[model samples]
Target: MTGAVLAERTEMVDGAPSALAALRRGEPVVLTHARERHLVIAAERVTGRTMALLVRYSSGFACVAIEGERLAALDIPLMEADDAGREAFAVSVDAGAGLTTGISALERARTVRALAHPSTTPADLVRPGHVVPVQVRPGGVLERPAPPEAAADLCRLAGLVPAAVFAAIPESVSEPLPTALADLTTVRVEDVVRHRERAEPLVHPAAVAPLATRRGLLTQHTYVDVRGGTEHLAVVAGAVADADAVPVRVHDECLAGDLLGSVRCRCAGDLAAALDAVATAGNGVVVYVRGGAACGGQPTGVAVPADRDRVAAHVLRDLGVRSVVLLTDDHGHAGRLSAFGMPVVACAPLTPAGQCDLRAGAVE
Candidate 1:
């Protein structure tokens, strides 16, 4: 392409309508910073195809970022404790003119405070969340801003509303960013959340069979979120129909512990215990959230706690469960479920001595 054509395309991308148009169509735009190339997509529009494309292009890491205003709109609670008891979703931003490449507690608290009130100084303009580390064997090279100026620039140049930034590096050099600028793929925020019309999950029912250890039958059903492209598994043992206060274990997916028998965590053992406990009770369910594994051996990335909880609740309601006994600790899970009037019993995994405690604080 001639410089004239390239300049025209740049002008189109730099135009406000250009960015909004790409985002509305669910496409990502190329963003260059310090000669490092990155793909900037709207956070709300992330989908399976977009993720696949990112995986194909990324060098290693990708993170979803949001502006301070958007973070405030999420209504996340302010930090209730010091650094020792900081919350998982709590993120920090630089309120003053300073460097913030790494996550700092003081910065996080200040960011929270700043968001709650008017800023004494202008923030550098971004915060990050839900980082997914991508590994590309071969592909186009891609990179994102250390402080998120690149994403902000893309949003500004494209005239797209800047709520959240989904930034990733593509790996291959064979295909550079589109010169046309308007033909990028984009999706709506509803696509990522699977809200309302897109909330229905694709269900796959597996065969039921008897288990020797539990002395009962087990049936597996997989629920795949069409919007997020993540799968959650449900294991039903015995009968669960019209079962009130069913014994339920919302186990996080553990690849190393559950499969490789890693001793660093009790995930594998706890999973088994939950199954035996449910079988002994003669009726219960185990909703295994795919993102829970502590070790990396699985492709499923971590799900935001809030989004995961909501999806799990939907699965339970569909299974005819009204109330449940949560098998693990994570008060956030209990608190969220409780709001829906679901009575939850936070229990610890059985000890090696064959004894267990129910009144424990946040079991692993």
Candidate 2:
């Protein structure tokens, strides 16, 4: 094994001469410290080609492991002399030595200590007279003036001096103000009031509607009564009605895995199979139930175990969707609809391949 040890300011660069020479010869290196060790495995060990350097940090310091061919391209310096080089060496040593703690933890501790002894409120990152955009209910971003009043309010919220607040304001508003007013303590009540007045008219409302009727989708606004409010709900149908049989799929909204096709979850595959099944029939409706339940008193956006399944049954029954096929990865969904009078089919362990075949009647 060949490695360097680093802690605090001092670092040791020496190692076994044979091992060090082996490393220079492009052989693998094993780093050890504090009873922990890590292997810098050569890519040739895994694959026939000499491509990458794979550093497998110990489990305690697993967070810092870097893989792939990028590491092999770096120029490995024989020694460290300057502060930057020393710091780089320290990082590698600490990472290889399995130092479980991160430098961020020390910085956070220092910040906490400083905040504990604070004599003044924190500085505001944003200032008044700046035109910050507000996202109104429906759709677009509304850029409005950060009047003195709003600035003062923001400063107060951020625990910053009002003058500091003014200075931080967008250049357009701050440039027009007198130099004296730019001082953190010199902001006037009238200035804030005037700024607020100029800002009041910029807020707007918006909503979202479906682009058009199509397979497995519907759309509507969430809140209709509030003025200047804009929030739209995109409803996807779970199952569509058919003359011979109704095909349905219960889908949960997975922002990352479904929309992004992240392999971490099966949401995207299941949704695609369901949509494909309904679309092929050319008559079924996919009643896209919102992931969470509509029940009052429940935490917002929490999907109750069987809420969507029940909703699906209700919608299907109302629409005269007989011979319905229920699709879902959640076993709880099947339990919820079991008591209903209609026949329902569930696709558990709902893999995309499995769902595709099931929906196509290739599997029972």
Candidate 3:
């Protein structure tokens, strides 16, 4: 990979720490989603410079992101409906009496401070005023992949109160984030998602049962999630816990290839081959995760959304699999997965058969 590609990947997977560091230092970060990007900073970090940045760059009126409970604490209700489809925006507000005409950057900054403060109550603000208040979902971006939730999530991750100030950046997707501001951090919604998975107990166990597959009778474990996700499940091919280091494949779903055998990708072949490898070992794991995580041969690596691996790491710990020989070619995963509590993937590829080029590594 080139230097730029490496830097971009770092921003995607491990950028949260840097973003949090920026927040701690009272700096701003650029936030990106699908086709949109925003300038975000912890509400507590709303300095004069930050406010100027928001005021100058925002395509619309800047908003403060807070939890639903915070919105209610201020006696604020939903804005009936969002015409723009930007959900969770409560009514606009000013910082009550003695507050400036809320439109000014300074005034909006004060209102944001009040919104983020713990002692601020309903009497502290007036409704239908200048500053827009957005109620982020309780589960942050994992529940709703919106800029408000993502902005708020950064605050939570940084150990501050879960409140943030964000405004749309009028830049296009192809444009580089304008470097006009100092201490400007940059991150993605996917970064927030990946950050949460890495830092929180993102997946929860609900049930397990025997699943009859073409390979054999695999034990399937299901999970409950805030996303109402059914796609995150695990299939244990054999008694992996009994082994010192079991062969494991953290597979992401690619329906086009896995089901219809679409030659667009080798997902079907790799999954089948992984299952076969585990079955043959009679002591391995094949974790099914990610709706369409992009990997190669099967896109299961650090460059991909290792949300699947993070999910798998938790599942493996839950399943009592102490160590693992990760079945993947992407050697980069070992370091990342280790942080999620699994030992680093061993350095060997378990190539039992079927051209599934799975790497084998020693787990120690």
Candidate 4:
């Protein structure tokens, strides 16, 4: 009847019967710990219905609460006591009540736990092979089953399986099964090829363009012209070579902050500054390109054909401009520009005061 006694009883039962099973027997167990009794019920029995139960303690204590089928299945009481007795039972119920429900509970708990803490599932930890369930969405509803090879390949990549590494294979051309199954360790050759394929088009030098908007200002925009078999630099040229003579502020699209306003980087600020600079130049160009990475909180882009720095270099080289002032929030872009024999000025340290002065110069 006391909380302590209930806990001792629950612990005493080696190979303890499930609360759900006990509820089916019409003999619901009263789990006691520290002179308190917590009611246990079969979740399945309460399915599609709500039930009211009384929680009691040895110190002549009691509380009443309502519970639904789903909550019962989760073994979590909807309402608990404000006292120590209820608090103690809550811990035991969370740990002991749901193990018998099979994979569903484990999966649900995995998701719930992941939201609060970084955790890996048994699947994440085991080497089940390179194969994983390929779904249209990651952690989304599965529409079609993954191909055997794709599953195996995923397993290998996850270290769930083992196999030989081979040359990278393109996801578009390669058979998903064989390509994925070919290797189960490191990044799959197919994955590497797929990454390269995705990245090549975005990073290729010829895919970029530079334009001068006004007498002293410029803007550059990058694009993927999939319409023609050849990559077109039309957008950049059109913006820069507009019959105006304004200075240009060549800006790369920052997928992270420009679109999402990620606080980690000053992508959006740089973009706004570029546009204002070009406008002040009275006739300038602003070349804008898509961010070269995926959309994420991190200061990096997703897999793409060309990186923003590479596109900037291509635009600068085409203009034949010597010692152009390159502005970017990230210093990483500087190293990238160096490879193209371009000079880079990391605009990171420029304060708002400095930016204001630069904008003034653009107008002058």
TM-score of each: 0.39, 0.29, 0.62, 0.28
Query: Which lDDT tens digits does candidate 3 get at residues 6-87?
Result: 3334333556778898887778788888778788879977876778877786675788889888787789888876433467
Model 2 lDDT vs. the true structure?
Answer: 0.32
Which residue segments of model 3 deviate by more than 4 Å? 1-13, 81-86, 172-177, 202-275, 281-284, 288-313, 316-364
The worst-scoring run of ten residues by lDDT in candidate 3 lies at: 355-364
Instruction: Give each model's whole-structure lDDT.
Output: 0.48, 0.32, 0.72, 0.32
Q: For residues 30-68, what per-residue lDDT tens digits would candidate 4 score against the true structure?
A: 332222223322222221111122111112121111112
Top-lDDT candidate index: 3
Clashes of each: 18, 25, 12, 76
Off by over 4 Å in 1: 1-214, 292-303, 340-364
Residue-wise C-alpha lDDT for candidate 1, range 241-315, written one tens digit per residue: 656557787777767668896554556777788888777777788877774334333334443555456567666
Off by over 4 Å in 2: 1-244, 291-303, 328-332, 340-342, 345-364
Query: How do the residues 1-364 of candidate 2 rate in per-residue lDDT, one tens digit apiece?
Result: 0111112101223233333233334343333222323332211122111111221112222111111121122212212332311111211211112223413333222221222222313231111111111111111111121222232232222333211101122223323444422221222222232233233322122343553445434533232212233221323333333432455565544555456645544456666666666555544445544544322222233545454454455545545555444554444455445423334443333343543211111212
C-alpha RMSD for every candidate: 20.6, 26.9, 9.7, 23.4
Best by TM-score: 3
Name the weakest run of 10 consecutive residues (lDDT summed) in model 4: 134-143
